[model samples]
Target: METQKINVAAILVVALTGIIVTVLAASLLMAYQRVPNYGYVKSVGVGVYWDQACTENVTSIDWGILEPGSNRTQVIWIKNTGNTQVVLNMTTGNWTTPEAENYISLTWNREGQILNANQSISATLTLSVSTTITETDIVEFSFDMIITGTEQES
Candidate 1:
């Protein structure tokens, strides 16, 4: 009877071990994978900087590496260099891959906000990569971000 009990114990252990391994494998298969992307920052009628002092000009934004279905945020300082109240607008262009527009999206925290002359505001830009982007063709991608400031007529 002791041998029979030992056999049952061994079977239970094996079953639990198999279950744990299966769960771990599944989690890994469903995990997020890294995808790299980048873009340039261009400002018109204003100054886009990395520092509050506006000493450092923001040239390019490197998202390092992005994970599918995830979002990466970059904070930038926009200082109104003009003498009048200006409204801020943002647009993207020069997409290396047209499909990138479908998989990637850019959004900012400041929308339709008027910036006063000599005033600075910190804005957060979010880059989102769609989970459904399984295309291996997009090994590298690039785009341009154009931030425009229009004078708000008094």
Candidate 2:
């Protein structure tokens, strides 16, 4: 009879220990669930309206003799027609076809000094065209200009 009673006591102790462990585990899970959640927003902003304008003009090219090895200095006139100041970027190209519309190839782009608002700038466009260019050889040019708020376009 005493042995049976001790066995019952041992079983009760084990059951009580298991219940306590289960309760502790449940409590820890509840605590973990109470943590706050943090997330990031994926929306971004973009430019809506940019209203700056610029223009460039090529004034003159000093002509040279038609030979195999001749270089000439071309004078260009640049103007900023926009209300704001502008920075002019110049690109050199070769004429490939008629109508002066088609360009065969392009060279590295170059930038001129800054100009102020409503201002005009001039630079010498120096190029070493082969003397094969006669008195009426057409040179292709493309103009690109950028305007900054802090810069002047004159």
Candidate 3:
């Protein structure tokens, strides 16, 4: 009779342990199953920047009469007229004229810089000429630019 009682007690303990483990596993499974339904919250904002129209405001400079064998500097203004800040990016293209065929160059300021809205920045470029550039003669300068918007979550 004592042996029978001991066996019954052991069986009860084993059954309770199995039931607890099963319940825990089922709870974990349900939690994982519902994870896909959870939604995420994000904040957003609006941004504006200079468009192509801003190019019209660019300042063009001409070094009228630098003496022969002298270097001259020309400063140009770039303005940002948008709601957001922008950085100036300059790109150069090749050009050829009757007098000069292989002496054109262009450059830009540091990359990834910022320009606040309605702010203006200037760049000074130097050119070395073998002969004086006549006031009546024109030297054409052109470049491409872009105004990118700030990144904001939606």
| Model number with the top TM-score | 1
Across 22-133, the per-residue lDDT of candidate 1 in tens digits comes to: 9999988896869999975433378899998888999999987788889999999999987778899998899999888888889897778899878999999999988877
If ranked by TM-score, best first, what sequence of candidates would result?
A: 1, 3, 2
Q: What ranges in model 1 sit over 4 Å off?
A: 1-44
TM-score of each: 0.69, 0.34, 0.36
lDDT string for model 2 (77-110, tens) is 4454445544555453343434232322222222
Q: After superposition, how far is residue 22 of candidate 2 from its true place, in Å?
A: 60
lDDT of 2 at 118: 59
Clashes of 1: 0
Off by over 4 Å in 3: 1-60, 65-70, 94-101, 108-112, 129-154
| Prediction 3 TM-score vs. true | 0.36
RMSD of each: 24.4, 12.7, 10.7
Among all candidates shown, the one with the greatest lDDT: 1
Each candidate: how many clashes?
A: 0, 11, 0
Residue 149, candidate 1: C-alpha displacement in angstroms? 0.4
Task: Return the lDDT, model 2, position 17.
Answer: 100
